[model samples]
Target: MKLVAKREGLLMMGFKGFTHFILVTDSQEAMMMLKSEMDWRSNVGNFVEDVRLLIIERTVTDVVFQPRSGNGIAHTLAQFGLMEGTHFFWEDVAPPWL
Candidate 1:
């Protein structure tokens, strides 16, 4: 949850709001955690419907995928965040040590 927050913060630093976002994860809990913090009334709805509508509206689509070995960066960053017990925003580049 904290890692997602940090990622969102990083995105906000680049632009106030993204036109589109897609999140995929193995854990429903992670998805729920993120949606819980969102503007439920305006932005979120039935997940599939929202995604389809966004596509129809010509909004950009940002996808988040959780595929064990495939999602190295997110996994690495998330693990790092958990280990450090700190939230850090990453921009164009990941942290040097990472």
Candidate 2:
């Protein structure tokens, strides 16, 4: 699900003409999988593949790990996304809420 979200978010960013992003996640494993080479045989490989394909077109400048315990803002934003079905891209400066 994380990979799927990352892929979809990146796709939207590309459509909006953004070329770079900093990916934040609670799963270190997912970050590593995305940064390393594609593992075609793994069960989650397809999801990673989708994200990787998008990365090829854009750029992932960094990957930060934000643990859930210290991630109240992310949690809130996620809930907002779920309820509103909206995608936001904040660049050059932090989001107003942040």
| Candidate lDDT values, in order | 0.52, 0.78
Residue-wise C-alpha lDDT for candidate 1, range 27-95, written one tens digit per residue: 555445444535445323344344333433434354354655776776787788779987667657869
- lDDT of prediction 2: 0.78
Q: Model 1: residues >4 Å from true position, as ranges?
A: 1-15, 28-65
lDDT string for model 2 (1-98, tens) is: 67877887888888888887787887888888888875767768988888888887888787678797888877676666677787765557766766
Give, for candidate 1, the lowest lDDT window spanning 10 residues. 42-51
Q: Candidate 1: what lDDT?
A: 0.52
Instruction: Return the TM-score for candidate 1, rounded to 2 decimals.
Output: 0.47
- Scored against the true structure, residue 29 in model 1 reaches a CA lDDT of 53
Which residue segments of model 2 deviate by more than 4 Å?
38-40, 79-98
CA displacement after TM-score superposition, residue 32 of candidate 2 (Å): 1.5
